[model samples]
Structures are given as C-alpha cells and as structure tokens.
Target: MIPAGRTPATVERAAEIFGKSFNYFQNQRLWEKLFPATIKAFHRAGAQRIVRLWDEEQLLALAAQRELPFDQQDIPVLPVADPQHPKPAEYQDEDLLDVVEAWEALHEAGSKITQRAWNTYVSRADDARETSAPAPDLEINGSRFWYRKTLLDWDKTRMGRGESPNAGRKKGSKDTTGPRIRPTAIARLAAAEGLLRALPNLPQAEMVKAIATTQNVTDRQALRILHEARANLGLPAPSPTEKK
Candidate 1:
C-alpha cells in the first residue's frame, strides 16, 4: 500500500528504485557496497523522500546485523526540492521482505555466491595450468569436477615447446593461463591439500629438504610450507632453526 499523502509520482519513483536493489540485497554480507548504490538509485528515480530511509543509524544497524564494516556517522541528506511533496515516515517492512525473498530465491537457483570468489577460482586455474598444455579439462564425475589430467597435458605441451611450464607474460595483458611462481610454489600446493593426507611421514629436516627439491624451492621456502602445512593439519609447528 502506498503511504498516505505521497503523490503518485513519489510512489512510482520509489518502486523503480526498489526494483534495481534486488540483486544488491541478496548477498547480505556485501551491504557496504550495496547500500550506497541503493541510495543513488533512489535519487536517480526521483524518490527523494525515500532517501531519508538510508540515514547513518539505520545503515549502521543493518551493518551490525551482517557483521560488515560501516564507519560513517553522518550521511548527507539531500534537500527536498518541492516543499509540498509528501515524505513517508519509513519504508514498508512487508514490501522490503518480499523483494529480499525474491532476490534470495533467484540467487539460490543461480550461482551460490555469498561473496565474490572469482579470484579464488582463478588462482586454482593458474595452479592447474602450471603442468598442462591446454587449461585443465573440466571433467564431472557425478558431482565432482577433476582437473588432474588437464594439468598434466599443460606440462607436456610446455616441455615439448622447450618453454617452462609457467612462462611469464607482459603485464596489463589478459592472463587466461595462470600465475607464474618462482620455485617457491610449495606453500600453495600444501594449502590445496586436505589435512588427512597433506603431510608426509619424515623427520622435520629431511621432510623440508625433500619438499624443497621436489618443488624446486629454497630450503627456507620449504620450511615455510611445512609451517603452514602443520598449522592446517592441526600438528605442532616445528621449531625454527638458525640459518647456518
């Protein structure tokens, strides 16, 4: 129901702004980025009355509920140009819930993105690309996707060309392949492993040395990997040794 005393133009404008805000509210954790866009959208829709709905107190309260960062104490309120234009006391709670539910349902059918994980997946792709010719072939066995063979193909192709598996390209260009790390990619490898089989059975010194050689990393880098692996595996970290 439209608020009492609001003109038809005001109600229409509010509805338009509300429509654009569905996607932003779906990821409740991303309210910081979404809130400002919502305020701007309201302004663009000529719903200056609804702009008061985004004051600092309400924003901070919403942020607190989501455990998000919102440090602004004062948000500048836009002036209402027409004195006779009616402003609602507050937004209707029922209407807001309806839109939020619709957004959640929409996202549930699409990507289950609570936060943007593109960089994380891209990092995984780069690691797999290190040893494969083409990118890791996407294989779906039931619900699981495997890329082990694709990585092997990448490695073979690079060797055939006499180029290193992870060759560097010029900056600012698209890097569809993956990241090029020095010999010190052991830590990343260890991180990918699960706690159950992540660690090998060996003395601390020998284990570090073995990883260093196999991963083509420095002994120091290997030690760092061991530290991280142990932490991930719930094992006690080895004492740091002096560099002789």
Candidate 2:
C-alpha cells in the first residue's frame, strides 16, 4: 500500500534508498542484487509511502515543464496516471545511478567525500544532462540555484582533505582553474567594489596603478578596464586629484 503523504525531493529520495541499501551492500558487496531486495524491503516495512513521494516529485517536474511560457513542442508530455512508484519507472535512471555511484565511491573511500569523488559525481551529472531527453525551454528556475548550493555544500563537506583540488582534470585545462585574467562583468564589478572597499576615496590614477601592478598590465589598459567596470556598476569614476 502506498504511503499517504507529500512527495520528497530527488536528493531526499536518494538518501532514503541509501539508508535502505547501505547495510545490504556492506555485508554482501552486491550492488546489483541489493536494489531489488531494497524495494522488497520497502514494501515489507510499509515504506511504500516513499514511492508516492517520488511520484509527486516527478509530477511536479512535469508540471513545471508544462508551465513554461515558451513553446515546448519537442518536450515529452508523460502521463501522470498511477505513476510508477520509485524504481526505474518513477525515478530517473541517471539520478538513481548518480546516487549509487556516489554512495559506493564515498563508502569505499571510508565515506570521505573528497575532491576526486566529487569529480566523479560531477562527471556523472554531465553525462546525465547529455543523455537525457530535451527538457522544456523554461525560464531560469530555482533548481539551478538549488543544485549549485548542493554542489557547494558537497565541496565544503570534502574540505581539508589532502585530495588535489584539480583531480581528474587534464593538465593545461585552464578553463576554471589556473591563473588567467578572464574577468566577467560580474567579476569586474566585484573588483571595482572591492577596490573601493579596500581604499576608500581612492584616486583614479592610484586605482589604475594598483590594478596594473596586480595584473601585470600597462597603466592605460588597467585604467580602461577600471573605467569600464565602474561604469557597468554605475559607480562614479575616480577623482583626478589623487596620486598618479
């Protein structure tokens, strides 16, 4: 019998599965066999309420797609009838796989979620997005922010480990790491504000000089970038009377 309650979030569902299957895998070391047994245990324990929660989550996801303002003709409109409660039908295959892989990796690593483990988690996430069917072209949603926060929390959890921060990344891959001056509009704005915070009422020439020295660029180039960044944030340009 299905439980009588609200649906849970994807992560919450994954956690439940982990709780149920953890011991089974620990004793038997059989991941493939543990899954079916866990589902059977869920029913035996009248924990099928979790399945309903999983169903609701799927419905909400589908409903979110339907609510998008943009045309979603290419999106799949799955039926919501007697939704498959959990397992391959109710939950996403990729999501389940992510939880499975992450749990096993972390478990093997003595439950220490290191940067390398995070890398594998993220690599699987990337694969999921690539292989999954196209979702609706909806407006920016909270899920993006939620996922970012989740990743950030996970990163923090793995802090202080001796793991390399750049694990699993190939050398010379300077996209997100390494030294580079690829400042975005947000970064530039932040720099301008930070400069003002550090040196209140700083002169334009001094600001330019500081940036130039830090960035190893000519004063003129730094001044140009500074002016543009200040303009972007609507901050007033530095006064000419300050030190050059």
Using lDDT, give the best candidate's number.
Answer: 2
lDDT of 2 at 163: 33
Q: Candidate 1 residues 155-215, lDDT tens each? A: 2344322144344444454874865553335445563233226445456777767767876
Candidate 1: pairs in clash? 131-154, 131-155, 132-153, 132-154, 132-155, 133-153, 133-154
RMSD of each: 20.6, 18.0
Q: Model 2, 178: alpha-carbon shift in Å?
A: 25
lDDT score at residue 187, model 1, on the 0-100 scale? 47
Q: Report the C-alpha lDDT of model 2 over 41-111, residue by residue, as the tens digit.
A: 11113322322123334334433453454343223232322222333244322222122333432344355
For all predicted structures, in order, the TM-scores are: 0.23, 0.23
Q: C-alpha displacement of 38 in model 1, angstroms?
A: 84
Q: What local lDDT does model 2 show for residue 99?
A: 29
Clashes of each: 7, 2
